[model samples]
Target: MGALMLKEIRSFLNSITGYLVIVVYLLINSFLLWMFPGVFNILEGSYASIDSLFLVSPWVFMFLIPAITMRMFADEKKAGTMELLLTRPVTDMQIVLSKFSAGFILVLFSILPTLIYYVSVYQLGNPVGNIDNGGAFGSYIGLLFLGASYVSIGVFASSLTENQIVAFLIGVFLCLFMYIGFEQMSELNLFGNADLFILSMGISEHYTSMSRGVLDSRDMLYFISLIVFFSLATRLVIQSRKW
Candidate 1:
């Protein structure tokens, strides 16, 4: 698993596509957090917190992750390497997991540099180090989990088809639905308690909750379940190819 993960990481680092994705992800994040003259811009806000940037990131990630993961499994299958890969000693689950982790870690690295924003905000506050360190830390955790959820969803989508475009579209749709669709659906009161159940299952709820500096075990468990469910589903999809 470690070797496979390393191979994935090396491949990503060596590829132009990977570099482009990382650059765009970080660039857009910078714009939203520092440059753009909007809510995310600290200059115009009541308090120059990084909260607006964190709040808007989910939407950006909805597109960015799929663009990054579109080639993970889909390109492998398209190039006919998947069959040879399946013949290797690794299990389907290992392949899925290693690829997922590689993609996830790459994104993590992109996010790490954004900590400069936190530091800058800390320094700029009324008193040096006056920022909500706890909330900022919790928000970073929330972002990681949210990005991990996207990675899982992207992996599952990639496993569904050999066409990267198809994978990308499937990933975007599922990501959107998981992140926000359920929450919106619940507001219609169509399912009553059922709506509540579905709403609670959405990623945005837990993500937003965590971003607010309150880390609930319920939210943590939800993200964990989401990652496990999608990883296993991807493995199952690959395993079925033998039939």
Candidate 2:
């Protein structure tokens, strides 16, 4: 499993695609946080916070993660190597997890460079570190879990198709739906007082809750459930080939 995971990670880093994804993610965020003169600019905000980053990154990952995981299983199937892979000693669960972990770690790497934004904000704070450390920390944690959820979703989407493009589109749709579709549904008033409950089912609700640095166990559980659900779903998708 570890070898397979490493192979996926290496395949990413060895190709221009991996570097391109990281560069694009950082460049967009850096522009919004530092260069662009707007509400998202750190200089324009009154408070010392990378809130703009937390706000913008989810949107970026909505596309970026799909690109990262699009080829995970799709390429294997396209090359007719999935049969060879399945014949290996690993279980379907391990294969799915290895790909998911590699994709998720890449997401983490993409986010790591953004810590420079945090350092910059910390120094620029009026009292030289007067920023809301708790909230900032919480938001970062929330972002990791959010990215993990996306990766799991992407991995499952990849298993659904042999064409990487289809997988990418499907992954993006799933990520976007989980991120905001539920919130929109709740706004329609279809559920009455249950509207809030419906809204809570989306990723945004739990992500926002954790962004406050509250670290609610329920929010963590929701993210874990999402990751688990998709991981298992991917495994099932792979196993279906046996029948």
Candidate 3:
């Protein structure tokens, strides 16, 4: 399992995929927060808050993470190596987890550099370091959880198709729906008294809670459960070949 995980990470690093993910992620964020002339630009907002980064990052991850994980299993099957991989001593769950871990690590790499934005915001504050450290820290944690959940979803999508494009589309659709669809549905009052319940089912609700600097157990549990659910689903997809 460890070897498989390392191999997956090494594959990402050896190719342009790893660098591309990190570079593009940082570039987009930097542009939105600095260079871009819009509400996302910190200078235009004239507020020493990195709220725009948190606001825009989820949408960015919706596409970027899928691209990162699109070829995890899809490329394996495409190259006819999936059979060889299955025949290895590792369990299907291990295989799924290895890919998921590699993708999540790549996501982390993309996120770490964004800390510079935080530092910049901190210093830009009137009193220097007057920024809301608690909220900023919480938002970073929320991003980690959000990224992990997207990775799991992407891994599952990849396991379902040998075509990387199809996997990428599926991953993006699923991530978008999970992140916002439930909240949008609730706004329609379709569930009546159950509207709040329905709204709570989406990632947006929990993510919002965390963004407010509150680490609720339920929010943490929701993210963990979402990740586990998709990981298991991917494992099952991998195991289906046996049947």
Candidate 4:
């Protein structure tokens, strides 16, 4: 599993697409937060906050993560190596987790560079340190969990098909739905008193709670459950090959 995980990570770093994805992710956020004159612009807001980074990253990940994970299993199956991979000593779950961990680490690599934004914001604070450290920290945590959830979903999507394009499309749809579809559905008031319950089913609500600097265990649990659920789902997909 560890070897497979390392190979997956190395494959990403050795490829131009991997570097391009990370670069694009950072460039978009930087332009929105510093250059573009709008609500997301920190300079224009005259406030020392990195909230814009948190606000924009999940949306960015909706596409970027799918791009990253689309070929994990799809390429293997395309190349006829998936059968060889299954014969390896690793369990199906281990294989799924190895790929998931590699994708999550890549997501972390993209996110870590944004800390420069946090440091700049910290220094730019009116008092040179007036920034909400707790909120910033919690938001970072939330972002990591959100990225993990996306990676898990992407991995599962990849396992469902041998075509990378199909996997990418499925991953994007699932990420978008998990992130906001539930919240939007609840807004229609069709669920009656279950509206709040419906809203809670989406990632946005828990992500919003964590962004407020509150470390709620329920939010953490929600993210963990998402990751685990998708990981297990991917394993089941892989197992389906034998049937």
Cα-based TM-score, every candidate: 0.97, 0.98, 0.97, 0.98
**Model 1 alpha-carbon drift over 4 Å, by segment:** none
> Which stretches in model 3 have alpha-carbon errors above 4 Å?
none
> lDDT tens string, model 2, 36-105?
9998999999888899998998999999999999999999999999999999999899999999999999
Any runs in candidate 4 off by more than 4 Å, and if so which?
A: none
RMSD of 3: 1.0
Lowest-sum lDDT 10-residue window in model 3: 39-48
Clash counts for the predictions, in order:
0, 0, 0, 0
lDDT of 3 by residue, 140-230 (tens): 9999999999999999999999999999999999999999999999999878899999999899999999988788999999999999999
In model 2, the worst 10-residue window by lDDT is 207-216
Stretches of model 2 off by over 4 angstroms after superposition: none
Q: How much lDDT does each candidate structure score?
A: 0.89, 0.95, 0.93, 0.96
Give the per-residue lDDT of model 1 (tens digit) for 1-243.
Answer: 898888888988898988888788778878876788886787677775889768878998899899888888998999999999999998888899999999899889778888888889888988888788889889999999999999999989999999999999999999999998999999998996798798898998899999998888999999999999999999999999999
Model 4: per-residue lDDT, tens digit, 43-124? 9876789998999998999999999999999999999999999999989999999999999999999999999999998999
Preferred candidate (lDDT higher): 1 or 2: 2
Q: Which pairs, if any, clash in model 4?
A: none
Rank the models by lDDT, top first: 4, 2, 3, 1
